[model samples]
Target: MSVDKRKTIFDKLLGSDIKAELLIFFHRNPSFSGSLNDLASKINKPIEEVEKAVEDFVKLGLLNEVKHYYFDPEADKELQNLVLEDLTKEESKSTFELIKDVEKTNIEVLDKLLPDGFPPSGLILILSDPAAGKDILSIQILCTKIAVGRKGLFITLDKFPDEIRDFMLEFGFNSSVFEKENKLVFIDCYSPQVGIKSKEKYSEDPLNFPNLSILISRVLKELNSPIVVFDSLSTLLQKGGVRSSLEFLRSLTGKIKESKALCFVTLNRRAFHPAILAASEEIVDGVIEMKVEETEGKVENYIRVFKMMRRRHSSSWLPYIIDVEKGLLPKT
Candidate 1:
């Protein structure tokens, strides 16, 4: 007789089939709480069998029992938000309406990138090498959106809110004024790593993916037609494995697309695994590849609109210069 080995590890760890099923049930229904009898009836098992499973879970600290009811003690608001409806579609504007709105925004930088402006709603993946000015480019884009009277939410895992503000100020963009006017918000994901408490609108432990999602969802829900910028996915990938990081991005992007908001996520090409980069490219609406080239020790930075779904854009790499007064300038 052939023995099944697939569940061997799980069975040994859970000790019984009923316990494994109970664990699986709680995992699938994280927000559920029920009395022992109710759980047994739901699982279609006898009361005694369910009781044994519940005892095993409680002893292993996987579940908590109080007054004959069992629940996952570790399940919190963050976990609940993580599993929230990611595909809830919002009524997006028509392509024509979106173009009109973009024109009304009057962002010059975007005018240079796409004479027509960004797509109505979609994700843009910004790829670049380290210190190649990816963050600066993202900030410039966000500042332009804000300048055009659009609200923005910047979730920065690479730099603290203060540092970002300082950089923007140096680039001649007054982001602090926007913060004071409530036109812009920053979710500081870097402060916790340095043991610094954040005074920004939203702050979260960068390594806690669930909390990060919850914070993002809260901001997206409150804002209207907001431009969201995630200041580097490579940092997230390092903190969370490729699977969890990609899953988080997929869920977050789904929410962004449904809300019809523009989102830009920076990814360090050298930092990400090739497979991860390829998978991410498939999920976004466009890919902006930034590169720095050195010819005879003179360096030049260029950007290419490698892909933009449902739109016509320049496929050739365009040279760009960083001017202290102008931010990112596309050289003609």
Candidate 2:
């Protein structure tokens, strides 16, 4: 019959090249009616191979074969345009260059109590209680960068992008800004535990970084963004163990120093091992430690900028609150 034109066409078009290229060939030589031999000689493919391919294309209704074969320009119009599309190739490098270039700028967003430009390209840590606002504050830091047209990567070990989005909205950010602009990207670490996609994603390419470090490294190298956030280091060490995870983090901090990106890392104070914490302390540019003290029924929390190496941080903890409208409000 009519070859069920739609089904056969889509199936064969899986390996099809641009229709525009075929059209150009026809334009070059208006004498287009050809057996596979004539078309292959013109197009520089082996006639035998072209014969089989043409047969498949004809079955798909993308070609017509009467005395000779001719392409049906309408059969796979949209797919043909995509096959002919050269856009993805040309703009890839510049996008990557822009992402890598963000590290050299001098502008920094620091605490109000501390000086304005804190830890410009340095590594920083957010240490806090399990349920504290460190993760929320980190998201605010990212949204702030995104508002300025800068980009950030969230390599989350504990939260999903949707949950992070919900958390952002809870902190007063409209999630659409992230969805529309794509200034924020998520690398789902999901867990240090061996469930679901973690182990496979971590080990998929054996040639890459060992365990979590490799995952983080490939991301930093590939991303040209100005900021990166590792949601929680404690989880990795707890799950992947001291030597593998900690060594990877140590190497990661070193690798990150070569770029201009601001690396904001998160760590859990209670569960974090001494070696991991020590590695972070020695390598990162600053540490923002969050702790809670209980007075009767109320529990109070504070953030101390314990150390900011290159940038001068004040003597004590910088106060910050999670404001409904403003997200993370730095106390003066």
| Per-candidate TM-score against the hidden true structure | 0.67, 0.58
Residue 128 lDDT, candidate 2, scale 0-100: 78
Could you give candidate 2's per-residue lDDT for residues 128-155 as a string of tens digits? 7776677767887877766666777777
What residue runs in model 1 are displaced by over 4 Å at the alpha carbon?
Answer: 1-113
Clashes of each: 0, 5
Candidate that would win on lDDT? 1
Q: Alpha carbon lDDT of residue 42, candidate 1?
A: 76
User: Against the hidden true structure, what lDDT does model 1 obtain?
Assistant: 0.70
| Model 1 poorest 10 in a row by lDDT | 85-94
Judging by TM-score against the true structure, name the best candidate: 1
